[model samples]
Target: MEQRVDRVEQRQDRLEDIVATMGELLIETREMVVEMRRENRQTRRIWIAIARKQELFDDDEFQDVFGDE
Candidate 1:
């Protein structure tokens, strides 16, 4: 009976450890997701700027500003 109790305690300790580790991993994953979203926003802004530049190049007034590239 005592050995059975001891085995149960050991299993409980291991389960607790697993849960704690999983919690830590969850937090890290959340932080990484936020960082990725920030990077995605920065990339989107760069794309928008590039598109605007392309539109300007197609405009007739482009020559008035830069005077022939």
Candidate 2:
């Protein structure tokens, strides 16, 4: 019947909408994970730089900042 066809079409439309929203969410999550990884790498580089400079500082200030390096 025509009514049954209409119902099926509506259901399909709703499913398509859900799929689109899920796809958008997946893309956003991937971007956020990538950004976090980049930030972590940058932080590691900064720590390495600080450690390399440790010999320049006197014992007390270095210990205060870097905790008994």
The candidate that achieves the highest lDDT relative to the unseen native structure? 2
Candidate 1, residues 1-69: lDDT per residue as tens digits?
999999999999999999999999999999999999999989867765675678856556655554534
Worst 10 residues of 1 by lDDT: 60-69
TM-score of candidate 2 versus the correct structure, residues matched by position:
0.68
Clashes, model 1: 0
- 1-69, model 2: which lDDT tens digit per residue? 999999999999999999999999999999999999999989866885676676656677666765743
lDDT score of residue 4 within candidate 1: 100
Model 1 scores what on Cα lDDT? 0.81
Looking at candidate 1, what is the lDDT of residue 29? Answer: 100
Worst 10 residues of 2 by lDDT: 60-69
The TM-score values for the models, in the order shown, are 0.79, 0.68
- Show where candidate 2 strays beyond 4 Å: 55-69
